[model samples]
Target chain A: MKFNILIFTHATATHYPMNYLASIGSYAIMVREVFKKPTKWRIMKSLILKEIDDLIFGSLGIIIFISFFIGGVVAIQTALNISNPLIPRNLIGFATRQSVILEFAPTFTSIIMAGKVGSYITSSIGTMRVTEQIDALEVMGVNSLNYLVFPKIVAMFFYPFAVAIAMYIGILGGWIAGVFGGFSSSADFVEGLQLDFIPYHVTYSFIKSVVFAFVIATVPSYHGYYMKGGALEVGKAATVSFVWTSVVIIILNYVLTQLMLG
Target chain B: MIEVKDLHKAFDGSPVLKGISTVFEKGKTNLIIGQSGSGKTVFMKCLLGLIIPDSGTICYEGQIYSQLTPEQQRDLRQEMGMVFQGSALFDSMTVEGNVMFPLEMFARQSRSEMQDRVEFVLRRVNLADAHKKYPAEISGGMQKRVAIARAIVMNPKYLFCDEPNSGLDPRTAILIDNLIQEITREYNITTVINTHDMNSVMEIGEKIVFLKDGIKEWEGTNRDIFRTDNEAVSNFVYSSELFKKVRQMYLEERD
Candidate 1:
């Protein structure tokens, strides 16, 4: 039993970074290796095309589907809360615009991506590192860092913008649910929406989405790229990626809001 | 050729490869053999520039490794091929895609030309039909063969295998060993394999290195190994019951 402990401990000692500065250097290494193999996978090209694909084939569904559901629920809830028909019944649509465009679309969709893109990056790279696929790439003269991370990062830069667009489109479904569904009048809802919100708020939403996209894509990859041991380590790295990325998103959102919001 | 001089590698505060020095000859199989945790992997990694040594120099063909630029190092990496223990095939790609990966990265071949080369190498490794299969869909032995095929796909000058026979049965292990040696000889590539299997040492260990507790305890070919009067070598080799019985039978016949 004691012998097992000793061997296990000894095994652990190998995984430690050899120097204090290794942490910083490894990230730079990760960035380079992930980005290096541009031509091999048609990575740069694929990134642009994938965003188009996500926009046209896939992401719109998420926005429309989520918005309609949320909008329907909001309409039902607001209909009951309002007793006075004389008051501005269009307050619901005005409130919906801020929630959907400023907060819900960008922040909520990013949370969704934390599950999709985040898990994919972490597991794929973590598996590659553990199974010696990354080492294989290294020996083959392929810059694993450049090859792996570049496509992911470039893809990330655009994916959130598309997602933000999706979320913005999604809020319209909610808007129609209020006005066309008789919960609120069309003129009042339209007037209420245009008058109350900042157009620059859309810019903030896009910027925030871009920021969230980076954190989601890179942090998960960082955890996976340095994964040691085997399948178990890959699993642990994926789990840790989720936890750390969630924490980073919250922290980054708070910071960006404070710094970017006028 | 690769020369590792006074290599000192440690894990946390304790040492794994402690001031080890060795040379691997060009155009021959250099076998580094040891039990698990004997630092053979570290030595191999150090030579390949995967891990940096604390206070030693790795001279690859007399060029100090650490001094090379990233591009030069990447170009240098093109000169070598590696076969990992897990066979490390890219799960997302087909076998042809896996073989074509290095070539696509380093060479300026057209798509059809690359396809031709991939087929040629796949044929060479007797994997002509497995080109379209994903790695997970293949058998373990087949995966190792695909790995070997991928390693040699680039026609590399040097080859490194980390426990080439790790998870295979005895027959499969011997087959992989012979394939490696045959490929090494055919290409005259400097082949280094890190393994603990005695079967490998006796079978194709043209120039063998025995590492114990991170030290080079013995270095010899299979022919000289049986006759050497070194106790550490004898203890390690003859500790196997199968080896002991075989040795006794040979001795009895000699008498």
Candidate 2:
């Protein structure tokens, strides 16, 4: 049993690296195809507009709701954790601002969007695959990747705008919670929000949001476009897409933070 | 017209299409008939350039497929239209949008001209009233018609149908088959169909190629099929008791 288990483990370890690299290579090829043989602008305009509605507008409600509540929770937790009387009450607002801007609004919200938008991209495209609609596009001599995935990548360029809204709403939630909960004065909370506010931090957050947007759009699309099999497999591909998108985003967040903020 | 010369394909070292040579003529309904796993789909997909044959050449109107540049291949693809087994209508688009998609992609016509073409094709497929309906909103038969309308809206020289009537009822299937035949004759399009439906073979088969184990077992017309004594062909053609009796009657009537 031990010998058999060791062999199985060895086989799996060797296979996954090659498989992972091959998947990345295939993803690069698909992205290249998306740029070639461009769909006519007249038709692509409508497609890009529809995608913006589906991916951007559709995601606003959840991003706002989660950012608000999480902002409140961050303020409350920061207020509770400061045991030293020497520490200023304004630190609660500072903590909320930092958390929401640097991580929550951009990275956290993106992880959530992975579930909402990522699964959607996968299932829609996978369903097209299962029903042979993708094949139909290819048969018509249309670049299926350019037709299906390019519009999505274009619409996600507006994702930073959504993240900016999340940042604003989060600070408001922090203010409301801090003052109303008797944790701090409204004047102090707003003061802390402006205190030492690095303009570059907002830029960094927007930069991260933009990077996450590409990851969100392309990762799910790669899964959906390459997936084979039937209806059951579409559901499976959506789940797998979500996992991979989240993993890539988290890894990218660490790398970006280390480079930009270290 | 399309010509396949010594075509071959295999998956994981197991052959699916093996050294098959055939000619699919223009202005005729050329049917490829076979049982399941007989490489019908693979052969059709190869012809569609969706699959690369392991060996051999597919010449479309004397433009050899493999030798053409990518741009040339894409240009060739625009002149070909295909109807998939599931109709494969874009669920997101209405019937009108589905039919108009090809024109919008490749044609430089004005919006009114494109609209007129869409309307004409929809009317041709008897789907004039269902223009605004989405694929999910309509019945399967109607979706097939929309697919057919889309396939022809670009005015393709070659029309390919992969089991175009698989899920349809007998009456609806026959209507779909007849519609394909009429369109083929009307436009003088080179129509290639992949099917296992004996009804379709008897009805629209101007030329039939029978594949067994990835090899061309027989080649003939629907009428000639009734008289073929090739054991495998006879066994397949008369697999059902009803077909056996019908063939006996056909032979006796000929006698």
Candidate 3:
């Protein structure tokens, strides 16, 4: 297993530069595309509206539903286990905050977003490509990249950020139910949470989400736009997009964590 | 008013378009017709610079596409309107939105001006009510109409249609043909159509270039093509049972 892992790492190291270069160029092109269209005001209007819709449907709904179930389980488990006398009573709050900002907000929010935003970017762009609407844009003298991919990038930035915020709130709900409402003293938990909570952590979380938004926007759009075959390829594109984006996000999180900590 | 000179294209290792030279005329429905795999579509895409030729010159009126920089080539490309084989309308957008898309991106038109143009084109295509409907909500014929509407909304100097009648019913096919022909005459647009459809050939082919096996086999108009004695074209045009019977009648009249 170790040997296999080493081989895989070497393989990734070889491929990383090409992907990195392509990605940076993709972002530059996306920025140029935004300038090719109407002013920022109209683009932002559409993007925000779309993002709000995506967040509400995607992460917000999932977080509320998932939080209640997970929260209930965590609460019962915490109540059953916390019989140690010397262990700090407020440790649960620290665990909750760290978990929310680091893992739950970025990772869980993405899982929900896979079905909502990622799949959407895939199918919509895939359909457009299959139908030849992309070609139509090119023939009409409109920059196909700008019109198709630009608003999506902007929309992505807003939607995933919204989803991350919702995921953070959902984690808090879980914490409240598990730490205070069910097991620990409310005062102890709240005080512990306030004491450890740093503004930098929040910034880190937001920064990760923004980067994730770029990944979600660009990867799915690229897959969809270059989609080949017929009806079946659309579904395949979406599936590939979900898998790749998820993997990239995890790797990115690890890198971000290393930078932020060290 | 488009000139293609000694154009060639290859994929992987196999050549798809040989040295093809043809002038697609202005103010007429000039056609590039061939069987499937005859490289007509490849030729049209080469004309549009979507597929660059291996070594050749495509001069749009007077400008040589091969010699121009990429930016200048892109600028020249913007003067074109294309109706795709599948009626490539944006699925997320309503018909009106799709029509107005080019205007919003390329022109400095105000919102109301764009709206008016979208409505005008949609009305021209007999899709006024359908404008509010998403591409998915519309029928295939309606989708094609909307595609045509979007293509012509810009009043392009060059109009390119690739297999415009595919997946369309016979009656709808004629309507699309007439619409395209009328638009071509009305705007005096240098209209280029790629098709092997005999019906279309008879209807609006003022100039036609025929291809066989990546090479130009014949070039003539619909009326002139019938009277020509080219053996390959005769075999192609008279291969059908219906055309065979029609040929017999023509021979009897000549006798």
Candidate 4:
């Protein structure tokens, strides 16, 4: 029994890496299919517009809500951590600026969207696959991947705009928290926000946003498009997509930060 | 006409289609019927080029599927329309939008012209009034009609339906079957249907291929089916006691 258990464990351990490799290979092929032989521009235009509405415009409320509270929390935390009087009150603003712009607005918001937009893309496409709608597209001579995923990639061009709004709201929330929480005066916080504001940091954030947007769109699409089984599997695919999307975003966040800012 | 020569397909080393060959004639409703696991769906998919056969050739009007280039295959697909088992209507689109989809993708017509074509096909499917309703809002029968409308909107030269009447009642199933037959005749399309509905086989099956365990067990017309002595075909065809009695009555009345 012990030997049998050992063999089973060994087999399971070896199988997972192979599965991961296979998934990666399939994902690469799916990406190639998405770029090949696109549908007519007129139809694609409408699809993109719809995706923008579904993925970006629809996500505004949650992004705004999360960004505001997290910004306020970051400000309060930074203010409380400073024990020395020599540390300027305006330093609260600087901390919030660095935290929100460099990481929170771009990376954290994407993690949230990896759940929201990622699940939506996966479940919708997965449902289509389950119901043979993708097969229907193929029978009609439509490039199903190109028709489905390319619009998503195009729509994610607007993702940076969502991130931008998050950035602005985040900073504003920091101001409100720092001034009203009595940690710092309004003037000092605003002054700190404007001081040493590196234009390059904002540029870096936007660049990260673009890459993260592509990951969010394509990863979930890959999950959804190739998913087999039925409605239950669609839900499972969505959860798996969200996990992989978040993981990819965090890893990319680290690598991109190193390449751009290191 | 579509000629499939010794088509073979397997999944995960288990053969689903084991060397089957048949011909589907133009302007006729050809039915592929079998028990649930008899690989009818797999056979239809192989014909549609959705699944590549492990061996053998499927020729669409003499152009072999396996030999065609990707671009050629795509062009061939443009001439084909398929109705999926579950209707496969785009839930996001209304009836008009669903029917207009193929035209929007393939046809280059003015807005008015596209609308006209959409209207014509919807009315042809007897869905003239359900244009604005979404697929979810309609009955199963109506959804099947919408699927038919979508499939025929492009005026395809070849039409394939995968269980068009699977979820429909007997009356609606006959209506859909008749509608498919009418369209096939009207358009001169080489229509292939994958179904297990015995009613469809008896009603509109101009030609029928019976599959058992991935092999073509029999091939004949509906008229031939009534007279065939093949036990497997008879057992399947007359499985229900009602059908058995009806077959007895049919033979007695003929005698």
Model 1 TM-score (2 dp): 0.89
Q: Per-residue error at B141 for model 3, in Å?
A: 2.9
What TM-score, computed on C-alpha atoms, does each candidate reach?
0.89, 0.96, 0.87, 0.95
Of 1 and 2, which scores higher on DockQ?
1
Superposed on all Cα atoms, the candidates' RMSDs to the truth, in angstroms, are: 4.9, 4.8, 5.7, 4.9
Model 1 Cα displacement at A154 (Å)? 1.4
Give every collision pair in model 2: none
The C-alpha local distance difference test score for the whole of candidate 3 amounts to 0.74
Instruction: Summarize candidate 4's per-residue lDDT along A75-111 as a digit string, tens digits.
Output: 9999999999998989999999999999999999999
Query: Lowest summed lDDT over 10 consecutive residues: which window, candidate 1 chain B?
Result: B246-255
- The runs of at least 3 residues in candidate 4 whose Cα sits more than 4 Å from the true structure, single-residue gaps closed, are A1-17
Which 10-residue span in candidate 3 chain A carries the lowest summed lDDT?
A1-10
Computed on C-alphas against the true complex, the DockQ of each candidate is 0.49, 0.46, 0.44, 0.46
Whichever of 1 and 3 has more lDDT, that candidate is 1
lDDT (10s digit) by residue, model 2, range A1-262? 0111222332343358655655675677777878989999998999999999999999999999999988999999999898999999889888999999999999999999999999999999989988989888888889888999999999999999999999999888888888999999998898889889999999999999999999999999978877777899889889999999999999999999999999
State the displacement of the C-alpha of residue B227, model 1, in Å, after optimal TM-score superposition: 1.6
A102-175: candidate 3 lDDT, tens digit per residue: 66666667665665677888888788777777666666555666666666666666654565555556556756
**Candidate that would win on DockQ:** 1
Give the TM-score of candidate 2 (chain A).
0.93
- Put down candidate 4 lDDT per residue, B25-132, tens digits, no spaces: 999999999999999998998888888788999998889988998878888998998999999999999999999999998898999999999999988998899999
All candidates in order of TM-score, best leading: 2, 4, 1, 3
User: Candidate 1 overall Cα lDDT vs. reference?
Assistant: 0.76
